[model samples]
Target: MNASTALLAAAEGGIIGDGRTGANLALGAGALGMAIGWLALARAGGGISTGNVRTGGMAAIAVGTVCTVLAVLHLATASGGPGTGNGLVGAIVAVPLGLGAVLLGRRALTRCRRADRPADRMTV
Candidate 1:
């Protein structure tokens, strides 16, 4: 299939079993993005020193955006409410998780930029 169609199918859980699959996938992605963002923020703040904080922040932002989009798509396409096995609750929860990730990533990015500037330079 084409790119758009394939993405829609993937977001819809691959045309397979129940609707929960998409929600679960979105939840997992959001959690992963949040974790990455947290680690990046820590690294930027000097709490960790093993990786590049800027790269981690960018990755977190991208993944978080994707997670939010997937969750929204699932919510839009879901057929039932909270108790009908449609994963409405999971999608609802994922929204904040994804936004949290984005916020953390942005914080880390700002820290990275602040650290990169040369505060001691003369403005001649």
Candidate 2:
């Protein structure tokens, strides 16, 4: 009703209202997406015989990237105070998770390489 009251409500509600719920959802979804991507990447690099790991790995990374981008976008664009809509939170969370995925993938590749090596058995 009153201008001051309306302004206060808006301030508490965020830019698009609902206290930036949309942003929160987007950011959360992004994190989950990144996780899925990491799994795919690792599986691809692992010594698995099925699912075409190479292609799956690439696709997973791509999907994860998209999710991260969306999270950053929402966190930055949404209007809120301090931690409410800050992109740093999402980014910080994503970095470590992403790194872990990379490590797993690298390990898988190493295993695959070692497996390809000739065995130490004698040629009886």
Candidate 3:
């Protein structure tokens, strides 16, 4: 299936178990993106030197985007209310988590760019 079709299926919880599955997936993606963004930020700040900050930042951005999209799609497709076992609450919660991850990733990317730039030289 195409990417959008797959994402729709995931949002509908058709790929696995019950209604909560999609929300759970979104939550996991958001958390992972946040972690990667944190690590990339640390690396940009010279706190570690094991991995490429740029790559980590890019990954964080991608994951965060996915999380947000999944959560939104779930929310759109979910039936009933928060207490109806439709995972409405979980999807709502995932939205902020995903947004936070995106912000963190963006910040890390900015820091990485600044760190990579060379010092300005005097012009004659």
**Cand. 1 TM to true fold:** 0.91
Q: Return whichever of 1 and 2 wins on lDDT.
A: 1
Q: Model 3 off-target regions past 4 Å?
A: 121-124
What are the clashing pairs of model 2? none
Q: What Cα-based lDDT does every candidate model obtain? A: 0.88, 0.48, 0.89
Clash number for candidate 3: 0
- Quote each prediction's TM-score: 0.91, 0.44, 0.93
Q: Write the per-residue lDDT of candidate 2 for residues 1-124, one digit (tens) a residue.
A: 7964543433333445565543344445455545555555555455344565444444445544544444454444446455755444554455445444444445444544555668884243
Candidate 1 lDDT over residue span 12-88, tens digit each: 77666578888888899999999999999999999998999999999999989988988898898888789898888
List pairs with backbone clashes in candidate 3.
none
**Candidate 3, 13-45: lDDT as tens digits:** 999989999999998998998899889889989
Q: Evaluated with TM-score, which candidate comes out highest?
A: 3
* Cα RMSD for predicted model 2: 10.5
Error of 2 at 108 (Å): 7.4
